[model samples]
Target: MKENIHPDYQPVVFMDSTTGFKFLSGSTKKTQETVEWEDGNTYPLIRVEISSDSHPFYTGRQKFTQADGRVDRFNKKYGLADENAEK
Candidate 1:
């Protein structure tokens, strides 16, 4: 309820590098870079490495790990007959 107690919340553009997806929202984050948005106005540009547009879940590029070969490698190195023996 106090006047001038909160930081300024201005229009911000979050740019996703992988997909070139820009998200416009109100935030208090400060930035020195500016870019013209689709709204024909310049705002602080925040560059991000990953976003939903390029993420594995959304783009279907997820990776699966297989431990089947790891078990054999461990047994061969440690000379253990039972690979799943107690540590």
Candidate 2:
């Protein structure tokens, strides 16, 4: 370990912009804004656009689209019969 060679790893608060969720964690990221947490401590506030709170995958709101390729799209667009539909 070298002296003054590592970033200052300290407690950080990540705020989800959409869900307004905040959690405390450790990081070396710097921030100019901060808010007092429930524990009566002020930590670095890092506003994030997406987090587990508002993420579609985490919130069970994600949509799964099956890709059938361009051929399937062309067939469906012009009402062309699908060869696979015969089976």
User: Which digits, one per residue and each the tens of the lDDT, describe model 2 over residues 22-56?
Assistant: 99999999989988999999988999999999999
Please tell me which predicted candidate would have the highest TM-score against the true structure.
Answer: 2
TM-score, each model?
0.70, 0.71
Write the residue-wise lDDT of candidate 1 on 8-84 in tens digits. Answer: 99999999997899999889999999999987999999998999888999899998876669877887788878746
Computed on alpha carbons, the lDDT of every model, listed in order, comes to 0.89, 0.91
lDDT computed for candidate 1: 0.89
Error of 2 at 72 (Å): 9.4
Residue pair clashes in candidate 2: none
